[model samples]
Target chain A: MKKISTPYHHGNLRQALLEIAVKLIRERGADALTIREVARRAGVTHTAPYRHFKDKASLLAAVAREGFEMMVKETKDQFSRTTQDALARLKVCGIAYIEFAIHNPARYRVMFGTGRPHGKNSALRKASEASFGLLLECIKECQKEGTVRPGEPMEMALAAWSIVHGFSMLFIDNQIREKGLFAADRESMMDVVVDHLYAGFKPN
Target chain B: MKKISTPYHHGNLRQALLEIAVKLIRERGADALTIREVARRAGVTHTAPYRHFKDKASLLAAVAREGFEMMVKETKDQFSRTTQDALARLKVCGIAYIEFAIHNPARYRVMFGTGRPHGKNSALRKASEASFGLLLECIKECQKEGTVRPGEPMEMALAAWSIVHGFSMLFIDNQIREKGLFAADRESMMDVVVDHLYAGFKPN
Candidate 1:
């Protein structure tokens, strides 16, 4: 194999490295990924990756941070695209979360995996908090609109998160398919599942 | 350091290997677990592990199978301890599931991780089916008792599974604590979460 080392500019170099790292993690599981291997794949000197990533953990943190941002963006885009009520918009956000997991299982795994960034104030941690904050905000909106039951918004948000996140994991892990619960239509299946959660959230 | 190679009977050797494998997985995570490592830790010859486990995948499959069986037993034991109604027993079963994940995060991860056994007919797969089947039966009983709303038993079961499973994953992954959502009192917290799910399952 011929090594193609293209000289990348500083800004582009980091982007290229991250892109390569994401690709490596996707092709091989995160445990198999390494800074040196990513550099090798990028056709750059082994030390080049060190300029951006101190170690594998940092690289994974960066990947997770990117995942959270992208997820937030995608979720927001989906819900905003619809002119539905707050509860309906929240359902759209749930669907978006699942779709993100389906489309980017590798990134999703890293984002939620045990190896995700730690500490309460790390960039990755903050990004994750923001991701949950998105849901909390939606729950509050639903409550304000009187579409959802009155309760602690955090607890309500968590109930919704549990349903969507759990379904995503089951779907991605092939458990749903293995059980033959996932017939051809994923959207409709999720629609019903989300409605079941909404039933609990409905105002009396 | 000195090595201790305590000879073991055939049946005991397999059990020892599994126990060591589980310990190794808990300490270093499943990716770092190897049959050779288990052998070394067990003070047995490397080749000896092959007698029980054909490879790493098979070793993990055995671990996952054991995890499923243990989970089913624990959930049943907890729910049966109380002479509660069907829905109450089902709630108890959900609590048991989360407790199992909390106590055996490593084993739980292995049971649900990507590296779990493949193929539709494997023993591991059957064990997982039976695990879900337990939940399905609980939902069925709840329906028969007129506690749960009428619907496809499988869908209702999936709805219940999603909440507990999702909550388990979040707690095990430390996301709950990271978000400050888990303020100690795991059982109470789980109780409230499971109630939200029950809100959806209740008949109108």
Candidate 2:
């Protein structure tokens, strides 16, 4: 095969490869992606992708890392813009997390999918930790402000994460809309769900 | 290829096919499953599987339906055996759900995986509804018994479902233990998580 070296060789080849790999994942499900195919799409030599991604799993790890970083960025953006109290602000972050999943379903799957990079990738693992860490920090603030009940911050954060993550998965799978389970306006439904998360339904 | 006649032909062929399909799915990921392969493994002619399942999607649909049915059975088993109240009963069901996911991760994945059977399968859809219906029924009872705060039963049930489902996904994906997010004993951890789910930490 004739080698076609494009401007990507001169300009940030690693970033270019990740961009194309993400595009491929979005277009086709992750199951069919290959490093050779990513290189072909990037207009580089078949071997060029190897310079950045040793194999398909590493390439996917890079995509997952990018996904976590993007999620943290979106959550932080919401935190900065919102003026609500700690618990309420945490709700805003949850909304941001769900919105991120809604806008990027394919990438969202890769971030949490079973095939995600395991113990081998520290960068990917750190990115994953950072995303969850944002929620942990918010819960700590909520407890400190007396808005949330006192408990281990990590456990409470996991509880909060469960609701948003579950809702996002169900929504992306078309389970929510197709089943007509919660037909109320989407934003209001999330608000109500968050309220449930804040105040569990146990009668006072 | 010569067709091998087996007792499954005279017995319950459909059940046999489903069993074989489940085994294949467990052994190999769902992506590689095919009707012909299943039939071949079942000691039947390639076209034999077509009699029960029209295509690969249909075969997958049957698998998903079985998963839902099995889940309902497991939940009901706990209900009959436990003496807990409505809200507590629901927690038992939730624990059963998480346990099912932990033990049968592959089947659990297929029950909720995106590529699962869609509009074409009514049996599959109803089976899926029945599983959620159990949770909704529990929430309705919880409301009646004054254990849960009054709200739209579906919405409350969904909140309950989201937490359990999200936890299951995270656990099966190795996110929970791998990160040491919940280091306590498994059952006690679930109990605390369920409590957080029941009584959200909002200060009175």
Candidate 3:
């Protein structure tokens, strides 16, 4: 392996710091991650991170933006490869969302961590909107398929988001005890959750 | 009220410390909480809390236990008041759970913040199980009503847990932007989530 020499001009200093910071966050929980530590691990001066991120919060926002975009892509890809039925594709999206969170728990936390975004940082917000848009599109397809009720897709969209987001959060937070939950049990639960979501919608 | 100043020989120093610690946690965030601070607030020696709580983790577990017990009562009470069928009552339980978290954000965080139980104390674990048992009872009712699918109720239990828990977590973390979500909107979202939950369970 070629040695990437240690130099101040590492071409992609912002990316470097963010990458190391994420690794640190994973190894040590998000609350323990620090700017000084990220700089130290990235072989840059503590102050060097300032050039890329004004503060840890903004750096975290950037990490969230990246995570959101990745999730958006993964969700869309999962939907595209699934069966033609909108209901099935939507289930795939839920599964994919959970899978993404499981795959990148650190990024998941960064994306939805303690603070809310302040302003029109449309790049980050757009990624979030795009991921949500995928779910909305799938719900629309459900309406078209006559499987989901046509009125107020927003209700369905919010419902889907809450359940998927809820499932992932439980898993990430380790609230789901595997001792009580079987390997095969998860699929059945998902079935009940996704399948049961149609109960209240009055179809058009 | 006689200001008998909780003397050095006061009855139940342990309970006193826990009470004051919870108060501090409610007022400020967890990071600002310390055993010494708690002891000081309790008007006791810094070593006093150690006699009752082995460490900070033990104290946190104690706090979480209090929160969990509150949830169990709230859930049971929510079901108790409603004259609706089993499923409708279960929805009330879900709302109560979210309400508990929303109203007591700090306590809710301590209950679900860590991946694992910080203390080896069985009391906290029991309290947690007891609260979950409420949900289990609700799921069993759903099963009886033939509203939930035939399978282990644990998954559905977890899914229900996740939707409300995830929503509460986001709302507590303030990730749900004020721009799009109002208090009324949250109620509507909850309605959709609980309704679809029944949909997910019923026969196709």
Candidate 4:
């Protein structure tokens, strides 16, 4: 392997490596991706990336954190649109979440489902909380407006979140097959899952 | 690397490799696993596995199918101890499923979370269905006994499966954080998750 020395200018090598790393990971499963391959693909010396990331795990964390930051941004963008009521905002948020997963399945999966230990990454942790915080606020709004059933606000948020997140996972994984796959009825099924959560929380 | 062309006279190289693969994957993340690594670890020639599996994907499929079979067996075993009531049986199965995950988080993650397709392996697909079939049957029993709400059996099953499976995923992923680093009151949380599912499906 010919080693190309690092360029005189860093010229965004860290971001460049992160981009290539994710692309390689998305095309091939993580098992097949490595820092050497990423460096090779990025036209940098293998050691060049080491300065930015001590190891592959650090690079993975960087990618995951970036993905999470984007998730927070996605939520904020959805919340920017005005809705007549809390229930409507809740629905849009749900749609937005699923849409985000569908668009960036691999990145989103790596962000949440990769089973990596991210406890050390405070910014990443805060980013995840920020997204969930939006959901919590919406749930509170729905509860106050009498559209959502009253419960511990956190409980309501977690429960509703489990439904939407679980559904999104199932949909992305295509786990719903042999009867769960309805005809072009994505919105209908989303409504049903959301409504199930709604029914459980509805003012009784 | 010296190629040990000596093939085993008896016993199962494939099975041996799989057993090693599972434990190694669990201890370290899946990214480090490889056919050559398994081969070297198992003391078999690199070519020895080719006789058993066409490639890494086939070996992984074998591993996944084994995981699903284990899932089915454990679920059935859980239901065998107690009186056979639909809801009760289902709850036990859920517990068993979570136990399998906690006990075998790596295998469980690969079983469902891996993005690689399980491919055109009928046995693998059938085993996956067989594992899920146990849940569907229990849900039907609930309906028959008038405990389950009126709805499509599969839809209900999907909901219940999502709730428990999602809970299990969160638990297995160790994503649930307890305040103050206290031991998580997982039993209470799991109970509530299932309780919500049961409540959502009670006959109106």
Candidate 5:
């Protein structure tokens, strides 16, 4: 491949490739993503992407990692804006999760969809764990405040994560719409689902 | 295209095509599913599948419908064999849900993963609703037995459904393994998650 003149240096090339890849996924779906296409869209030489990402899978992993980081930031931003009540802040984080998935369905799918497993030490896996760790912190805070029942915080975090994650997947995948349950009112449906979860975590 | 005669009749031909399509998806990913490939694998002429499916999307919808029916039957079978305690039965169904997804990851992804939306009256949509309706019935049963708190059965069902569905997706997608959360003992992790959900639904 002939080298093309471009302004992007080695440092910015990876970010350029990821941004272009995300655009392709958002507009045409993940199947449309190809290293060549990303390079073309980025206005960089075909070999440029190769320098940063060893393969398409590596590029996808990087995108997924970016997605996880964005989710953690989004959730934290939501959490910070809410009341200090542990339960209330947790609810806010849960809602933020759903909203983020709703707004970024393609990215969300890439983040959680079928892909090569990133090993424990991989940046992608670490980013994902960091996002999950936020939820664990919320669960622990709720326990400390006596709002949530005492139990394994990891288990409680898993429960809360499952509810939100499941609901988001269903909503994004059009299952909720197909069922005609809360089809016309998604916000209220989310509230009801979260309320049930809140009740579930309350001290008996 | 020449019409190729086979052992299957009209009704059986549809089933054969679906089976072949499912096999292709299982071996390859969903993107590997194409009308021509399914027809070739089914030992029929390339045009034969068009007679039953119209297009690739239609064929995928049929497969998804079959998946939903199978899930409903699987859950019902487990529900019937469990003890009379509503909570116990609900747990059985939840476990059944996870097991089914773990065993049939490809079909489960086809059923719940991103795809063209099935309209309200579509068979695929109806089958999915029927599956979810079974969960609602379990929540109602728990309410009758005074195991679960009395509330909107729909909301409670959504809560229960979210946790199980989310956990199954995470497990099947290899997110749990990738994060090293429950690498050695997935079964135990599943139990803990379900137990928390069970406690969540109890009357406070």
Candidate 6:
């Protein structure tokens, strides 16, 4: 395979380092990542990464931020392909969230795993908030259509998020596989899970 | 502080090593664990841990098994204290699960984290199944009492597990804290989250 190389310009170098870091995380595990290793993989001088990342944690935060952005885009794309019915759109978005994690298990782990940067203004935190904002918007739409029960939108959003996030974590962590649950038809199992969640949102 | 030391007898050594392993994971992280380190911490010879555990992974499996056993006990204790109303008992058990994770975050992480042993007869796997069995029993009782909607018990149980597990992961992983989603009172927030799940299980 031909080695992928990036030009040494400041902008290209930073983006190149981030790309290499993600690739390394995917190929190996997050523990395999390092500035020197990413720089080597990017075919840049060892010190080149220093200009872009202050430390390993900072690099990880960047990777997590990228993961969040990709998740938001994928979920929105999936939701957009569905009908205008808020409930249907919510279901599409929820499944998309799980699919994103299942397809990109390593990135998903880093996105939610411990040790990434955390603060009000941190890049990763902001990216996560943006992704969650998409879910909140979907819930609001459901409420507007009188499909979902009216309540504090944040609480409802968190309830929706917990179920999907929990399912994804169990799937990614192999808990679902280990227990021999949903082995034959995962898509159907997802429908059952989503349907249960949708039932909770209906006005009682 | 007095260091807790164990006798070097073969039987005591194995149990001692497991306890020390849990302690090390709590203080540092799972990656910090090793047979040699656990043995040293247990005040045993370097080769002693090898007698019980063939490798680090095996040691981790033992730790995870212990975590599951403790979780089962904790959930059962909590359930026994609640009224016979299946729904009420289920709520108590669910809260116990989250409380167990919060109080023993490292052990909880190891219990569900990737790369541990997984097989039909593996000790860790059996322990996990047993823990999940308790939840299934609660759901069954709910169905018998005509509280929860009648359906496939397994599906309802999985749905319930997903929500609580997701909430615990989010709380433990600091996702809730980072997003500033629930700052004032987490206990009440948990009630809201669990209430949404309970609503789903009600008959239409």
Q: Best DockQ goes to which candidate?
A: 5
Residues B79-117 of candidate 5 have per-residue lDDT tens digits of 778757887878887888888888888888888765345
Q: Rank the candidates by DockQ, best first.
A: 5, 1, 6, 2, 3, 4
Per-residue lDDT of model 1, residues A50-145, tens digit only = 787776677777888999999999988887788888888888778888889889988887777743226643898888888889899988999999
Worst 10 residues of 4 chain A by lDDT: A175-184
What's the C-alpha lDDT at position B84 in model 4?
Answer: 68
Query: What is candidate 3's TM-score for chain A?
Result: 0.86
Question: How big is the positional error of residue A21 in model 6, measured in Å on the Cα after superposition?
Answer: 3.9
TM-score for each model: 0.90, 0.85, 0.82, 0.85, 0.84, 0.86
Clashing pairs in 4: A149-A201
lDDT of 5 by residue, A70-107 (tens): 99998888877885799888888789888888899888
In model 3, what lDDT does residue A57 have? 75
What would the DockQ be for model 1? 0.53
Which of 5 and 6 is the better model by TM-score?
6
Model 5: residues >4 Å from true position, as ranges? A1-6, A9-13, A32-52, A82-85, A119-121, B1-13, B32-48, B83-85
Over B1-204, each residue of candidate 1 has an lDDT whose tens digit, in order, gives 543465445446888888998999888886678888899988888999888777777888888899999999988888778798898888877888999999998888878775222575389888888889989998899999999989998887888888899999888878888788766478788988899989988998
Q: Report fnat, model 1.
A: 0.51
Model 1 deviation from the true structure expressed as Cα RMSD, one decimal place: 5.1
Residue B29 miss distance in model 6 (angstroms): 3.9
Better of 1 and 3 by lDDT: 1
Provide the RMSD of all predictions against the true structure, rounded to 1 decimal: 5.1, 4.8, 4.8, 5.7, 4.5, 4.8
Candidate 1 vs candidate 4: the lDDT winner is 1
Q: How do the residues B1-204 of candidate 4 rate in per-residue lDDT, one tens digit apiece? A: 754554456356767889988877887876556888888888878888888888877877788889999999988877878676788987886777767877887888777777755556778778888877898898898889888777777666666666666666766665556212113376766666666667777778
* TM (chain A) per model: 0.89, 0.87, 0.86, 0.86, 0.90, 0.89
| Candidates ranked, most accurate by TM-score first | 1, 6, 2, 4, 5, 3
Cα displacement (angstroms), candidate 3, residue B141, comes to: 2.8
In candidate 3 chain A, what residue range of length 10 has the lowest lDDT sum? Answer: A195-204
